[model samples]
Target: MEATDCRRAFPSFDEPALKATFDITLVADKELTALSNMDVKEEKILESGKKATSFNTSPVMSTYLVAFIVGELSYVESNYFRVPVRVYATPGMEDRCKFSAELGARTLEFFEKKFDVPYPLPKMDMVGIHDFSAGAMENWGLVTYRVVDLLFDEENDNANTKQRVAEVVQHELAHQWFGNLVTMDWWDGLWLNEGFATWMSWYSCNSFYPDWKVWETYVGDNLQSCLALDSLRSSHPVEVPVKRADEVNQIFDAISYSKGSCIVKMVSIILGEDTFIRGISRYLKRHQYGNTETGDLWKALSEESGLDVAGIMDTWTSKVGFPVLTVSEDGNTIHVRQNRFLATGDVKPEEDTTIYPLSLALRNKSGKVENINLDKREISIDLSKYDASSAFYKLNADQAGLYRTLYPPERVVKLSQAGADNLLSVEDRVGLIADTASLSVSGYQKTSALLDLISLWKNEKEPNVWMEMLKRFGAIRKTWIFQPESTTDALKQLLGELVLPKVNELGWNFHAEESLLQQQLKGTLFSSAVSSENDKIVKEALSLFEKYASGDAKAVHPNIRAAVFGAAAKYGDEATWQRLVDVYTSPKSSVEGLAAITALGGAKNVDLQKKTIKLTLDGTVRSQDVFYVLNGLSTNVAGIQILWDWLREEWDAITKKFPANMGLLLNIIYICTGSLATPQHLKEFDEFFKSKDTKGFDKAVSISRDRLVSRIAWLERDVKDVEEWLAKHQSSTKL
Candidate 1:
């Protein structure tokens, strides 16, 4: 029901701005129930022995949000809010809806209070659709979710699964006001709906559970992803032009969802949070049940903040890429310059022309923040007043801006030391690691420099900081997959040294009284340890997996179950693989099934890898869930070549399985070919696609090509540098 798919359901003016009120009526079997965007008004038994249900007239909404369902559905209801909030699933799964039902009710109440608006509808219903596409759809009051994203078994599911469900429920509920009440005028303004929902969901989730520290995760998860995709030359503007229906699916990427939210976050930091919320509340109240363009939102914000909101934000939305702020210092002044950043590290003169309005919220050792703006290409500020000699200052403090900050090498070292001393916020530490990693990839700095900077963070405690570090290490390892075995072993040894201590400290047990962050941290450390082939962790994981596979459900903790299964697949024989398949076939919960499917790709045996790939097309995997298997294979060095070869051999069959227009075809293309880094790999990729029509996913191909080129350049530029660093440090690395 997103991106103008509403026309496929019925004939009408299907544009977003052309909203209409709908009166829905359904005739179904007497035992089934019917639901719509509104509450039911009447139900009657027909003479033909069926039931007819009529709903109240819905408020003005886009056609895409118009939904109806007639099924033998069972629901769990909550009266904790202004109206009834219900979570529905098949009859046998009613108990699984209790968590979502309570969370959804509380989220609705939280949003109503924040936005200063009431829930206009009489009831809210969230249903789990087994074959649904997308994570979840915000279909007015009747939201539809993929069952895996909605249902949860608190005792059996991991901490990550709980976090995902909470965020998805809160994200869809946010659309009730941001997307449904105030619609986007056209497809080009889709970010207005998606970006705001993403930002609002995090905002509300943080409020409901501050202990989750969602904002820290946002720096690593949302901010870095957008920055990565936007660094490519093939990337489009956040407000990209969509000339055809097929082009709309291509723009539903990291730019619109992640970068768009990052922009909103930047604006909120500039204007105080309270003022930002006030301005958005005014905007929503003014445009209730109406359509809007991007400018309308800025105008409302300008009226509240008394600034040229559009002047500061227009270029950010219209431009294709973001800027990199290069910082240097003189005796008493600090100099900063902005330029367009590219992953290939080769920005032509024409590509480096845009100047972004930057917010340099500089902070010093005293915890005082200085709000400074650089609207031009370069600027100089006096730092003597802040005692710059005695204290270190960080720009883009807390990473509230959309641009990357490149400090001098010495400053990077100082910041890393500050992070180690616990003098910086979690967001600041994440941004420091992210910035250095990116700068290294783009050639603004050397790979050795990034390695040196992160080496100082061996004592880091925050999960998000470690997550960023591990991601950077993973990128390096993947790009060097074809190097000598000795080189890859050295990198693995380095990873073991960096992560094993944390793994041993956290151990492989889940405590009921632990904070959510600690639980997530423990899982991350164990997974990294297993991947690095740490002998102790691998031995422990195998023992636990053996017991778990032998019918002891509690042998392995839910937090580390996925890692244990992966170790079993990677090190065990055919019998272990068969047990994993059995678990996948009959899982206790949806998350457990997915964990098994993802682990299947970790099989080190070539025959087992082939078997996993065959499962994708042998009717064992649902069409919607094929990506999980392919994505897992893409990450496995043992399975990467196998998956690529399978793609080349089965191109037509794979395309037929996932049509180009469904938006999933892009995911298939990425998972199949995105990891290739060598020049010969690029040639093969280009040669294979020479005769195929890439009309719908042409952008995907271009982005993949761009990434491959970047990886090739990085490997060529830093291969010897990384090898030497590892050689020098390998003697001191501990297991």
Candidate 2:
């Protein structure tokens, strides 16, 4: 009854604007407990000798927040501020819920101060259901979570898992104020709730765990995710018009979550942290226990920050794409021109007069920061006082804005100089790399240029930079991994050279005094190492897998479990594959089970690939997690064609499988279309999806089609140049 289906539970107005009080009564077994939005008022015995519990009338809330659960669930309770917090799970898994409980209580207390609003509900329950989806739902007094996102075991789970658990907890609790207390009027303003929560969850998590670099995680993961979908032609605007339930479902995509969150981050930078928080507090207090639209937030922020915050933010949320700031030198000033940034290169006709309220951060030669707001298409900053002729100015200082910055090629080379990585901040470096990667894939820049820029990062020790590089390189690598044998071999060698040195520097073991982020980087580096098939890394991973199988106490730590298991599956024979499958099928934590499935999907044999494809649809994999197998199958070079065949063979059954959830199919489509290098791959993708019942899934199909088209264009534009560069690099290294 959460989303848009509260009418099914009881008779009531289901629209978000129709906020009302709920007096819920439940009749259940005497041994069971019932929980709702409000504290219990009374419990009485029915004529049949059954217990009936009625809760106090709830505060004004939307129908989505009106819920109750009656069960014999186990829980661990604690106190946060004046409010009590209880974390619940299935009976035997009660101990696994403690971490989320501690994290959730801390998060609620933090928000109470940050939002300038105290906890409204007397008690809050965070429940982890085994079959839950959507990561977690913020249901006022009671939050619901998937078991994997909420539960963590001390010895079995790693820092990465705990970080995920903490972030999810923080995200859902932030909603206690943003969504539960003052929700959007309707689905048209969904981003107001989701976007704020997404951005704040990372902000709150960073405040709590400064060492993890959660903001960088936002940039490297969430922000980049938005750029991927936004680059597609089928991408939707943030404030999407929702006239039907299906339209409502389509809007919960990267555009709403990622782009909206990034824009919010951009505005937050301009407003300054303290000012931004104050504005947020005002917005929440003014609209508490009521519904809001996007306008209400801007009005509050403008009143508090003394800026047209909403006016500055309107262009971003109303549009589907962002601008790329082109900077050039003009006499004693730096001239900047804004143009719509497209992944496939060039701008559209209607985007000419299109403007963005740019938050310009210009860094001078003295390392001073000057912030400017461009409410127009063009602006100039006089740099004569800073000796403009000597050194160039850096725009979008520290990457404070959501848009990309395109520097002249010579200027880019200057910035890519040795030791210059330390001159600029990590966020800008991440921005530069991400923008350049986007350009490379789109033909605006060559793969060689991207490679040259990344060579400067060869000595980079920052965890977030390495994380970005790992992901970008993997995306580019996936485009042509199925090339001719020689070309593919050369490509593999080049990739190994790019990442293995960093892996060697980081090493495989956890270091004393190292931060959790640094430790997490080890897992990513090892995954890169195995993917590249570095001799030293492959040997080490195999040894670790063998030692663990032979019952060695300290062989492969849980942190690198997936990497070792993947290596074993990639290089092992029938026996190793069977061992992984047996362990995967047995009862275990979600992470452990997913790790085994990951290895099974990475198997190098075609027969094993077929088996994996079958498992994706079969009941073996959870419906919510079938994308894991789909993605894994496409990741393996031997199964790309096999995956296509399976897609055609079972298109109807697959689409019909999830009548309730269609967005999950979009992710699978993206993964399957990832390796659409050849024309035949594109044709096959079109023949299957376009010829089927893809009415509600048109945007997804469009995105996947555009993805394949872009991959094909990338191959045409960059493959030859990349091959030449790889050959030259290989010869030079040998010399």
Candidate 3:
């Protein structure tokens, strides 16, 4: 229904602004149930002994919101909201719908309160579609989700699974108001729908479960994801022009979802939470059952805050990339310079034209935040008045801006020390790590500097900070995937040293009373330790995996089940691989099946890798789940080459299989080619796609190529720097 696909269903003016009321009627077998965007108004027996169900006329809505489904479905209902909320699935999976039904009802109620609007529809029905291409479609009152996103088992699924289901359910529910009620005028304003929904989902989720600390994770997950993509030359503006349907799919990327939400978050921070929500509520009320451009939202926000919101936000949305602020200090005044940032570290003068409205909220030892804006290329600020001692000052406090900060190398060390002394917020620590790592890759700082900085965080307590550090290390590891065996071993040793203590401290046990973050941290540390090939962790993982594979249900905790399977696959023989395949063939739940598929990609043996690849093409794996297997393979050194070769050999058959689903094909292309880091790989990628007509996925291919070029340049520029650092600090512990 999204991105102008409604015309494929029926003939009508399919653009989003062309709103109409739909009278949907379905004729199905008498035993099957029928559903639409509205409640059923009448039912009768058809002449052919089938049932004919006619739904009430829907409210004035876009063509995409019209939906009708006839299937043998069962549902779990909840009375938590004023209107009936139900989660439906196939007959056998009714029990799994209970969690989503309850969560969905609560989320709808939360949105209704926050938006200052009641649920406009009579009933809210969410269904699990077996072969869904996207995560979920917010089709007016009838939302459709992939089975995995809407169904959950509290006992069998891990903490990550629970969080994912909650976020997805909440995200789609949010669109009920943002997308369905107040629609976007055209495809260019798609972010107006997606970005607001993404931001609202996190806001409501945090309110519902504050202990989860979803905001902390947002820095590492959402902020960093968008920054990575937006740094590329192939990236587009947030409000990109989309004249055709083919161009729309490419904009449904990190820039629109992650970067777009980041812009919303930055504005909220500037305006204060209460004021921001008030403005959003006002916008929704004024535009209910109507279409809007991006300016409509800005006008409402500006009126509420008494500021030129449009002036502050237009460049951010209309521009293609963000800026990096380089900070230097002299006596008391600190000079800050802003320039367009690119991952390749080679921004030409022509490309550095955008003067973004930056939020330079400076913080120091006194815990006072100065709200300063830098609209020019450079600015100087005197901090002596704020902090006489000049202990430590950080720009872009809490990383609220859509820009990165580059401190002097010595200042970076001081920030690390400050973090160790508990003087920085979790967001500050994460931003420091993210910025330093990115700077190192782009040659703004030496790779050794980043190595030294992360080496000091072994005792860091926060899970989010550790997660950010691990991701940086992972990027370095991937860039140097083709390095000498000794170099790779040294990198793994460093990783093992950083994570082993945490692994031992947390142990491999779960308790109901432990916080969700604690459970997630334990799992992350254990998996990382195992990946580093530590003897003790690998031995323990195999032992648990052996017992679990032999039908002992309690041998491994659900929290670390994937890690155990991955360890066994990475280090075991053919027998272990076969055991994992059997588990994939017949699993207790969909979660277990996905875990097995992902673990199969970690198999180091060539024959095992081939076997796993074969399973993806055969009927054994669902087409919708093929990306899981390919993504797993992309992480393995041996499997990376194997996956690219397979993708090349099977491109035609793959395209034929997924001709209609551009999003899935785009994911497959990324999984197959995104990890390639060598110049030779880039040449080969270009040669292969040069002749192919990549009309639907041209942007994906361009991004992949651009990423490879950046990786190759980074490696060529910093190989000696990384190698020397690793050699000097190489651990005696063997991988």
Candidate 4:
């Protein structure tokens, strides 16, 4: 059952007012285990012979936050705050559970001390579910995590992954109070819960892992997703509406999580941490076990700061896109104008009237930081008095502000070359690189900008800094390399000597190595034009997969196995491909059956591709099974056609018969059509689009327009045919 469905399981309301006991029950499969809030109060072998267990219901509290899971679990149990804490994982994953246990315990301790509240639940259980869709869910005292997100192997000292686990765990734990205890009135106030959680996650993780710049790391990852969505025509208010159950899931996005966090951080940076925490504490107390909206959060902050948050945050949050603050230096005057820049293209530029509390940061040559704000469209900062040689300015220096850069072309060029260490804070630098890389695709950015970023870490002193630089550089390299012959031996030598050596030096263990290898292969393989050297790399990858695939099934993690097969599918010989097909057809195939299908879907053979599509649409396919197949098909145009055909053939049947599939279809449509929403496909795609549910379908359509259609418009130089089609459909369709 969906978590929302559980509302009826107990006397629970969406608001925080509900205080009810959830009499929890779990029919744990003999192969798996279970966990809950309190210690297992009752455990028995059922008459029918199943491991039936029950945990004591939590203290009086809202129910939406409650969570439960049953899976193959191995746990290390301990006591913290006089409350039980068990970090659970799949069988043979006991070793990984240790990392999470340490992190979770520390996280619980941090929150207990910070909030000055007694731990409310009887026991805290962090269970790693292999197939969990989200990072980790804060289910009151019982948290359910994805295996990778929660579990960290002792052997795997990959600092990045370990840091991520600790950070994510703390983030969810904090939600115990922020989201679970004090719930949002409507989904609109989702930022209040998620944004705060995201911000707190970075803050807590940075405290716990001092070496890791958690806030910057988070913002770097976040900026990509936020900029992508914000540039989209479909972008909505951060505090978006959730009138139906499905709408709740749509808002669990970058804007709601990362950008929302950015917004919260902005408030904290501007209002000062003391005021931010004080305001949040007041909001929690005032809304404990009650419902509140966005205004309520603004009200709380306003009460503390004696400043109006409504006017400022509302302008940013209520609107769909972000502002590009163009700062130009003309003599002593620095002119600033806010505009919009799309991740894929420059679409809706900022109107002259668009406004926000423009928190500005100006760092001079001496590394002194100055704060300034621009309320109007244009503001002149007199820099005439400053040393001429000292004239260097970084807007939103700490990445405290929420907007893209519109600096001089030379400045954009310089920032790209400087990487994270020099021109910008580590977090903000990633944003610059991503934005610049997007521009490079359009010929607006120079390729040298990319090479500079890639070559950055060679000179960095800190290992973590070096590693981050390598990671981002590696990412850009992969994105830039698509055509055959794009790979050079010189480039390969750089990656091998510089990139691969650092990865190995980190001693990231087999799992982390495999993960990075996958990323590296993605960039290195297709990057070069089809050549003997490229074939050599492909053969090497195939050899690794074959060697690993034949290993002790128990030795390989399911994800690693999936990756091996995925890589093999990308670069394998005829015999290797056959072996993969054999695995797919074999009845003894494990949960990785869908993955095998993905491998075959991408096979050069058209017939096999069609069969892969059929495999997904077949009644034998589980709803869960569709994801891999859908993803595989999305890699190319032919696969996309097959998917579209299946949708066309079975739309009515699937919609009527597979009720559980509606949400999945919504997601699939968004990803599939959205990816190809360029001018060429817009006309063909119009036949399938029906705007019966504006709030629902329009979201997907708008996303497609932003990500796919807009990019196509720029590339093709005309969109009259697409515009005509969309216009006709808009009039005819119910939306």
**Runs of candidate 3 exceeding 4 Å displacement:** 388-390, 731-735
lDDT rank, highest first?
Answer: 3, 1, 2, 4
TM-score order, best first, reads: 3, 1, 2, 4
Instruction: List model 4 lDDT by residue over 676-718, tens digit each.
Output: 6344467666656653344445666667655555545443432
Q: lDDT per model, in order? A: 0.87, 0.79, 0.88, 0.61
Q: Give candidate 2's total backbone clashes.
A: 0
Candidate that beats the other on TM-score, 1 or 2, i.e. the better one: 1
Off by over 4 Å in 2: 29-33, 42-51, 329-334, 379-382, 386-390, 418-421, 551-554, 660-662
TM-scores of all predicted structures: 0.97, 0.95, 0.98, 0.77
Model 2, 558-623: lDDT tens per residue?
789889989998877878877777666763577877787778778887677777778777787787
Tell me the TM-score of model 1: 0.97
Ten residues in sequence with the least summed lDDT for candidate 1: 383-392
Which residue pairs in candidate 2 collide? Answer: none
Question: Residue 595 CA error for candidate 4 (Å)?
Answer: 8.0
lDDT of 1 by residue, 598-692 (tens): 88888888788889999888889878788888877887666889888988999889888887777788888888887888899999998998888
Error of 1 at 19 (Å): 1.0
Clashing residue pairs, backbone N/CA/C < 3 A, model 3: none
